[model samples]
Target: MKLECQEKHSEIRNGEIHVYAWFFNRNVYENNTNVITFNKIKSERSGKYTCVARNKAGFDSDAVNIIVTYPPIVWTKDITFNGINRPRIIKCNVSGVPNTYNITWRHYTNNNQLVRVFNNRINGVLILPEGETNDLVFEDSGVYRCNVTNGIPDESGNLWQSKKIQVKVEGKPVLAKPLKSTFIGHFNETSSISLFVLSSSNVTQAEWKAAENRNSLGHGCCSSTVNKTSFNGKCLDMSGYTCVFLIKNTREEDFQNYTVDLINKNGRNTFDISLISSGVPEVPSITDIYQRQNYIVLEWKPTFDGGAPQGFIVQYRKKKDKNWESIRIQSNETNDFVYISKLKPDTEYELRMLAFNRLGNSSFTVQFTTLFKGETKDVWTQFNLFLCIPIVLPVCLFVFLLWYRKVLHDGIVTMTKVWLLDTISIFLVTEMTYIPR
Candidate 1:
């Protein structure tokens, strides 16, 4: 704390100035006569301090109060445990000089949300200057922060240690996701089987056993025993427990369900994996399309069922458009045609056909086109014009001659008379030439 001169007038005005300062009713200083200062301030420096200035005119006085605040210090190390059957306690170990700060516990969830843990309990989270988590799970593993704040106000004050805590809880082995009842794999193709275990557990050995028929390859082909890691960026093992199985070449005899057995003193957990063939169905093609007043009918044919029951799917859209409308065939239906009603008139649409089964879908997409009622009428009119052109042209010329029959008869009579005169002249010349010869 510091105090300044409080004299009412300077000594230059012929009035001598003197100042006095003291902690209210505590200590006083007269030799300084103008200002008071402290080398260091602490909790003890709190309370009121008074200042007085004297002159020939009289005296003036003023007072001020000082207060100090500090945050609590905490440890930065992580709190860890081997396993939990009951509650586990973790202390914050915070210290404040005057014991003038409050303790608050915070739990950071897996989804990155902060929840206040107070009053010694909230679900699995408990708070009392220490954090206690009961029946911990893999989701409970995250950052925990212990915050402290004194009632005092200071701009430059702070805690002396780190506030973040990393908590790790170990427990029994549990699957991240349940295995499927059946999986599809191609013949003679490589396949992968992955299993994830949460944290560290009592299970020490993980083994895979093939069906009785495939006993020739004993112990099955399992590889890449990942410890404290994840597979394909999923099933992250925070406690280092994961196993993977890889088959180089699948065979028909290996189509049975394989069992994975995990053994330890605690007990044993087993899961079976069934494999099936993923054969693709044959491609389907659209054969015919008929347009009516309010709807269009489409027909398609599929060649083979690909060793399984097949279903057809029809998709269509406007010509040169980006969006498409789809129709799924029913599983019980055995026919190959579908009626698509409620269509716009005079519009052009492109259709696609394909077939699928439980194994896989066909590799090809058959494309076709459908014409609306007005568009079909335009096609028929063009065909009629071509068929009538030969017959109509000759009839049209005959009609024109009948409208001008008199002019046509006069011209024909004149041409016939001229031809007869020319013939006569040619005959006379020919007879004269033969006589001269």
Candidate 2:
């Protein structure tokens, strides 16, 4: 590529004229040259070129633009079809040396069958047949190819360039098999329910909603009254041809007619499923008990939740006390054990724990006694005394015999008195004292 600047004035002013050429503000040639030549031009070399001729008198500058053209590069903007029977436009972006080009549209079906859509020398937009007479259908869903050519070839010498546009015809969601009308879920536990779809048709969203109903009233489960407000649960999973809904930490209020709404561009469809409880929880049993000073640790194995979440109510009272103290424990709080503190030591207590759900409660009574603080101390003291007696008595007897022999050799008659006095002093010093634990 070459760019030249011609001198216009004939007046020979001052000094020899110096000419310079610049491409996009960078000097490409200098010194008495009015023409700039670019070797091996590329797309990057296409831009503005400026030429300046300057003398001792002054300087004059001019600029011109240069464009390099290549073969057509084609791409399409994403297009969404509202639903079956909707008219849609697939547009492509095309760029090349010549603005005029021939566009060819082809579609590949699911079975890899090729079908021509259109072939014409026109702008890069294809409009599908619209109206009720020529409505789009699910069969029209496939990969649409947009190919363009303008005689110019790319660096690889390929005359045609193409882009694939995904065309999907959305419709109402269709279930593969009818979902079960009823589901059994446990309260205070995670429940996962799913449904299969034959043709999701681009299911964009799924929602789970529960109908208004009264809370479960008694051991007779599954009874409902329409006196409450409806609520929504989280839609756990929505992918491809399946929808999974989750009821986390299920509650009594969750047992109702649940509506699963599947939504798409075309429309939405709702499926109904009734959730019911299994039954009343089983009676809780105490598995183990640990007694401490002024406190007791009770451990129990969890029983059946009876199709619903269940918590525990612990009731206890001192054997002599007339009133019972109660503690409510939530299902999540019980890690197999309950700590009952601030109880009187050396007192007999009766405890009963019951598992209750929305339906009813079942219980069993147990009795345990807290140990007196000094009781453990006394045991330890006795243990220490028992160990000391055998060793201490032998040592004392040996020492007394030696002293008696020495006193007899010295002709002293007070050996028995001294021995008795020493024995009494040792006993006094070795007396068991209460040790705080």
Best candidate (score: lDDT): 2
Write down the RMSD of candidate 2 (Cα, Å): 18.8
Weakest 10 consecutive residues, lDDT, candidate 2?
A: 223-232
Q: What is the TM-score of each candidate against the true structure?
A: 0.42, 0.37
Residue 173 error, candidate 2, Å: 5.2
Number of the top candidate by TM-score?
1
Worst 10 residues of 1 by lDDT: 121-130
List candidate 2 stretches off by more than 4 Å: 4-14, 19-40, 43-48, 60-65, 131-135, 173-437
Which residues of candidate 1, in runs, are more than 4 Å off?
1-38, 42-68, 81-136, 150-162, 177-182, 201-204, 210-241, 263-269, 280-314, 317-437
TM-score of 2: 0.37
Q: How do the residues 1-437 of candidate 1 rate in per-residue lDDT, one tens digit apiece?
A: 66676644444464675535454545664444566677776655566777776667676677777554444555657776554434545566654445655656676643345543543321223332323332244445556776655444344654433377777656555454333446666578786666655544455766777765434333332222343332222444233345566676987875677777665454555666676666778888777888755778888777867656788888888887998888999657988899787677778888887788887788657677767654244666665565555455555555544644655566754777666655755654454344211
Clashing pairs in 1: 228-240
